[model samples]
Target: MKAKKSLVALAVLGTLSGASYAQSSVTLYGIVDAGLLYTSNVKTAEGGKALLQLASGNLNGSRWGLLGSEDLGGGLKAIFRLENGFNVNNGTLGQGNRLFGRQAYVGLASNTYGTFTMGRQYNALQDYVATLQLVSALTQFSTHPYDNDDLNNTYRTDNTVKYATPKLAGFQAEALYGFSNSTNFANNRAYSLGANYSNGSFNLGAGYARSQSPGAIGGAIVGNPSSATPSNPLLDAARVDQWGVAGTYVLGSLTLGLLYSGSLYTNSTFTLAAPRGTIHFQNYEGSVRYQVSPTLMLVLGETYTTVHQSGESGHYLQTSAGADYYLSKRTDLYLNAFYQKASSNLQANIDGAGGAASGSSQAVVVAGIRHKF
Candidate 1:
């Protein structure tokens, strides 16, 4: 009788353990990317000079993270993700040196409803519109001039609340709001809204974002307005508004995409002339990707941008092309090249280089490898 009781107790405990294991799970994942880069016409006081160096995150930022979820029954779950960004070359943190600068969010997800999250996160523009666009979807080198549209996710919002709707009838929608946490309302605040639709082989998306006093010192937004970082130019403005539309069509092994965006900086300090009023930028882009084989792919993209500021207008044209070869499911090699030209008094910023420009042209080439685990 004691043996029988012991066997029953062991079975009960094993059942409970299996249930507990099934109710929760955690995963760790990461990507590492690094490359050698060469740039032509790096601006300097004396003259434009070439640059050669080791680069990190040529196609995607290096990152590692933990994602976990606990089943809460009734089709609901508690979820959290903590992601970190770092430089592969220097083995240093990337996003403001914060351990989880890339993303840190926790929320509840309902299979019947949707998801609600709060923390540092990407705006809706990045989640919906930008990801579908070719310039932002392709290699990092393909971003619009200076990433003026924020399509490359130049900055992320902190202290944010976000809601994402479950896909219904091939449609999905999401929104985000970032608080300033200041006495003066609207100071350093940001908001975004976006939606996407997918049907058959066509996908379309659009989004809008606005920020007040973005990059203001000691404000909700962090960074120095005058400092030039690899991913951020830190252009200060009283108010900024941006909107974009993007679409992609897939056919067999080829995909084509189109993107358009407009950004307006009001009462800006980054303008060329004094008495700063507003600086406007409009971008148009197109891109194509072809899978030559199961393991090889080719991509090409182009963007044309117009800048309007203080009765002056400038034109910029940027082109990017690349080839990617996959050695394994989690590892790949790539070669990407980009060229940008400016006309009509436009300062040649050239893909966030923040250099001195002798002329209106800049070019860069990057060869790299990426691994995911």
Candidate 2:
């Protein structure tokens, strides 16, 4: 009888140990960055002037996140991530003051299949095309004029359901839909699709997104409209359509990239002080990164944008250069600069770093350090 009881007890303990091993796994991760910045041509109702101040997120945004996974047997797992973006200077939330503004998602993953998630999340365009832009390589300061096409991740979609396919033969695809969740059903709907192909050192991607009345309450787009220098003006439009394509090639320690995107805002409320009208913008950019040594890197890029209104047109030209010295795998120091010139009635602006420019040109310089944990 004692021998039989011992066998049963051993089996129970083995099962409990297996369950614990499969269900208990969590991680904490974060990045912190701080810097000093100089800006020329900050425009206000009063006037424009050059200014210098301490800044955060010069090379990368400051953020902290928690992620966890549970193995559910049968090659499937449950996963979740909660990420928060914050300003290092004042210790405030970054995305419209939301605690987990950067990302908050719960999903399931399968080794043979792909992953599916739901919650506030990034659209397909940002995941596929915008991430390949050279402007992103140079940092937020080099973002395309106004970041009109969402390349700089100005906002995220709420009430979203997203699916990403497993990479097969160097190809992967993603789709997302955000619900308006209103009585009208489609009052503020948003959706996007994107695909990418990679082989060896070359990658190409494209994506498209559309939204209607996005500025409505609890909508897909999120930003502070009252701010003098809003990041993206089309967020308040009656309708918005955007698409982009990007490619990058790597050779040894050198990399080159090219990107193009266009955005159309129909019946937009904000058009550089215009009351209402249709506005369109096209942006093209090229960028290169070279490793000077195992610890040092260099980057350069340029972007040109063309804008069209009912009876007016404008243009923007921007140049960026930057360098980074790696102190370790998780820490780095950097210097970066950007100069932009606007034509016609378009005002120069670098969101978060500088205000709208009263004149036709704006320039900014930044130096910073970043650490990851």
Candidate 3:
């Protein structure tokens, strides 16, 4: 009788363990991308020079992440994700050498309600409008001049709380707030809102974001590095505002896309030698994608950007093209090229190519492979 009782207890424990395991799950995923890049013009102290080098994260940033979910019953679940970005070329961490720089968030999700998460995460423009822009989806070098609108996701917000609404009638919305986490509550704070509507083959999205005293604190929406001078041009701004709208439509084997975005910075200093003033940028983009076959796709995009600062204005015109071929569901090869021209004493600087051009025009080409697991 004693033996039988022990066996029954062990069976009960096993049953409980199995049930618990069924209610929780964790997944590991990653992407690795590398490329051979060539630039027609890169500025030097003396003159422009052509460059050829190996680069990483051409189509997508190389990253790995862990995602977990626990079913808590009553149509609610606990979810968490930790994502890290790295440079495959030199095996160094990206995003200022911080671990899990891409995203680190945990919160509750409900089927009827929505999701609430807290941690380092992207803002509204990256979540909504960026998805609708073909350039953002295709390659990093295609972003609007210096990624002024954050559509290319140049930065993520830290100490952030985000809420996303459940899809209702083909519409979804989200909002986020990033606290400064300092004695001064308003310093380095940020907020954003985004919404999207998807109906059949057509989609539209809009988003807005703002930050106060960006780069004021290490844990703020835009963190400051240990170095005395910041690397990014917009880091030392007193205030930053960004807004955008985008739309996409699928017609047979072709898809059409359009995007418009604006960024404004107040009391910002670009460099140690530069003066503090207000700077504004406006971007307009259009793109088209054609599916040649089940595994081959072609894309073309163009952008016009205007900048105004200190009673002077400049403009940039950029054109980009790409072809992608899928070797398998998890692997692909791509060739992309870009050309940019600047006016009014502005220097052409294609995103992710390297430095600014010595002249008013620059061009770049990249061939790459991407794999996902």
Candidate 4:
């Protein structure tokens, strides 16, 4: 009888262990995007020349990632993610070639409480306000001047801790802090806060972020200066502040979006002329998306950006249009076009294009296919 009881107890324990293992799961996901690109002009020492080439990540960046979750009982869970960015055309790693440059984080989550995560992660601007751009068909191609406000997720914060509140009454909030890990304490540190609200057909978001002595510490807010290719040229700044507000409304199959963002780089070392003070950028954008049919969608957008320096200023007016045809639930074909005009003798440089134009105007057209799995 004693031996039989021990055997039953061991069987029960084994069954419980198997049940726990069943509660854990891991998923692999990725996106591949490639396209043919045509640029009206590419700046060169000889002036400007039209160019055609194969481009990667026109609508979305090519990337792959693993997401995992383990249930901890009572509405709690342990979660983690590792994401990598790459160039599909050259088969090269993106984001300075880090193994998991896009995102890598682990956290605990509770259905009743909020979530707390730590690792290399996106700032509040990228979490909240940047999502508003998804309603636009041109998504990544319509970034605000050099993505200075980080609306395009140009970079991620390192050694960071973040917390997000559970949605209540259509409102949610989040905050983050990134440590410099230097003896100086404050050098290259970063912080951000953001909030979102949604009601019926309307959604709104606002965010603010600041970094001190960005790029001064390795793997900090902007990553290492030597390895990271920051979208904004003025990364060597004493301080960087970014803030933005965006809103979107869905009316049946049509959506409208509007956004405003600002980036301020103070005491920057990179400058066109002497006596560098501050470089400030303000961006305003409006976009509309229409679903023409079950499988076709179209978008139109315009952006006006202004830049100011110690004693001079410049302006940019950009227009964008695109169409997407869904080949299936996980694949699509897209066509996008962009034109930009600049003032104050500044050259027009469309994002993702090879180079800037020698004149004040530039245009680009791209046809691509995207697959998600």
Candidate 5:
């Protein structure tokens, strides 16, 4: 039986190689997820609206791509991947009309030294936020007070290089650096490090990242309005720094996860403006999940965030619950709800940034289906 299986595998490889026989073994795989969504008091910059919404893959953004690896011999392999994300409803590039935009990179993989690559990429914090959450890492739901930076961001850094280590006793680490690719004032660089370990029901992870004079929105706290208008401490840093630690434990049919994060800044400068004050933010998240059945789950989670805008500081709280059922290994259906309240100097929900509150809060409930192919 083993010999027969080997022969079958060889035949498939042979058929695939007919397209490019002498070079390498290459394969392609990807996922596409989509769903219809609704928001209660949808906050838009113009105003708030309540209506039926058809959101594309809020849980797992619909994506497709190609991955290939060529044997370079000498225990080294040339590897490349071009993944593109798209909006299912309108059939448009999901991330800013970028061809092979989601992840476009080429690098080398080695058995002994690990692997290194370069291109548009995510920082350490962006990758680990999912493992630390049990709501299946819902982008529109589980993010609560703040979504995972990477999932929500369409474009981060342009040029970059990354290295990931081979696993060590169920432990692995990665490091990344990004360059802005500019002529004058081109010292812009961002760096990050991440590490994780998993053993049985217990899993843990930690990560740190620093952005040197990055773009303001993704950069340090540039706050609202540019730096020139009086000094709003929130806009004090051109350099942004972030660090996080998160863990999960599975006990019987229940799983518990917790995460903590902090952000710091150095000099917040703006384009065509002077300088503002500094800003720092601290966030904490906790969640619990119970397996009600083989294909059903019950979850409850909360997030607390405190934003320190120079001397003045404010805080907010968010609570959420959601569930997912696997109709099959590659398809899922889900429903979720969120209730959020704020007591802060800043006014913003997950959707819009500025609003006048009755010290009022908002809520959302959504049901969606996701299929991966």
Candidate 6:
């Protein structure tokens, strides 16, 4: 079967090539999703960016890009994709000025078995972490404020080789391994494996991930000669750990989902000159959603987080409710609002430590639209 397909592909490419007209195809595809936004307490009490301002991603980020796959030969194929993310209002590049920041990966696919690829890849947590957020396409209202730990970025490993299993009987699994890009102990890296099962109106999935850091990023300003600005070290052995599970089931016009996540910081210490011994930090969460109609639906979500400080203990409850409406296949509009409250060792916040944080409680509300193509 593979040999026959290869010959057919070569024959088609040969007939289309060496022709008079431009035979190569470079098509463009992307999303330009943006809308009105209203945010409260955007900054600190020190007169930071706190106030209602127009924002992007009330639904999605504004972006555009290209994708194409060429017939190289045999059963093998040559494929490349470039996607860029940007702010629509002022036209600024998103994801830190990366041309293909949204996604930049190239590799081959097989008709049978599976496909292998490499690049900066989204992690398993993204697919299984917090429910309310991932379900909303990683909504801003639900992703942060609860855990700035960024189980989001930095967590997304770089230089990764990923394998996606063929979808069979509504079942699929993904495996990924990332390189630390270091000279020694390449094994000192990160990786994850996750699988999803979906059939009819029911769906479920679970995942696991592990990553490490050489050390914390404290600098001269904190009082260290090694840092250009003088730095601090909470713990020379500080490392970041994260893992989570998510599941969702749909019936008729309604769908329900749940998620949980946690992190561990070993040898978590103070950013001060006098460091303490092995301290620790962790987090937990849960959420759910329901659909009212195809164009309009209701969302009720909540997350609970607990932190065990080296010397203090704290926790917070975040509850939210909102509505989502699909304007079209490429466009979606939503309004989300959430409230947060903290307790137990409430105000004694951690200093400039590289461990889990227990910041002050705040509320967030936003209404926006997203479009994809």
TM-score of each: 0.91, 0.92, 0.93, 0.92, 0.80, 0.74
Mark the regions of model 6 whose C-alpha exceeds 4 Å error after superposition.
Answer: 1-27, 41-50, 71-77, 128-138, 144-155, 186-188, 214-237, 268-286, 344-359
> lDDT (CA) for every model shown?
0.82, 0.85, 0.88, 0.86, 0.66, 0.56
Clashes of 4: 0
Ranked by lDDT, top first? 3, 4, 2, 1, 5, 6
Distance from true location, Cα of 282 in model 3, Å: 0.3
Better of 3 and 6 by TM-score: 3
Compute the lDDT for candidate 3. Answer: 0.88
- Top candidate when judged by lDDT against the true structure: 3
Q: How many Å off is the CA of 155 in candidate 6?
A: 4.9
Error of 1 at 298 (Å): 0.6
Worst 10 residues of 2 by lDDT: 222-231
Looking at model 1, residue 353 earns an lDDT score of 39
Residue 285 accuracy (lDDT) in model 3:
94
Kindly report which residue pairs in candidate 4 clash with one another. Answer: none
User: lDDT score of model 5?
Assistant: 0.66
Pairing residues by index, what is the TM-score of model 5? Answer: 0.80
**Cα lDDT tens digits for candidate 4, 1-373:** 9999999999899879869674877899999999999998789888889999999988888999999998888989999999999999989999878889899999998889989999999988888899996423584768877777888877889999999998999999999999988888899899999999999999999999999988674636763346436535576788899999999999999999999999998887666323577889999999999999999999999999998888788889999999999999999999988889999468788876878788889998999999999
Q: Which stretches of candidate 4 lie over 4 Å from their true place?
A: 1-22, 134-136, 223-231, 272-275
TM-score of 2: 0.92
Is candidate 2 or 4 superior in TM-score? 4
Model 4, position 217: C-alpha lDDT score: 45
**lDDT of model 6 at position 73:** 47
TM-score of 6: 0.74
Residue range 1-373, candidate 5, lDDT tens digits: 9999999999988878765643576566656665555555555665666656677767676788788888776778899888888888888875557677578888999987898998777666766554575345544555534332332443344577899997788888898887655553334567889998888998888888876665433222223344332223323346667788889999999989898877766554421112245656677889888888988877888988776554666676888888888898878788877777777444436532122233336666667778776
- Per-residue accuracy of model 1 over 132-179 as CA lDDT, tens digit each: 876444467677776777888777888899999989999999989988
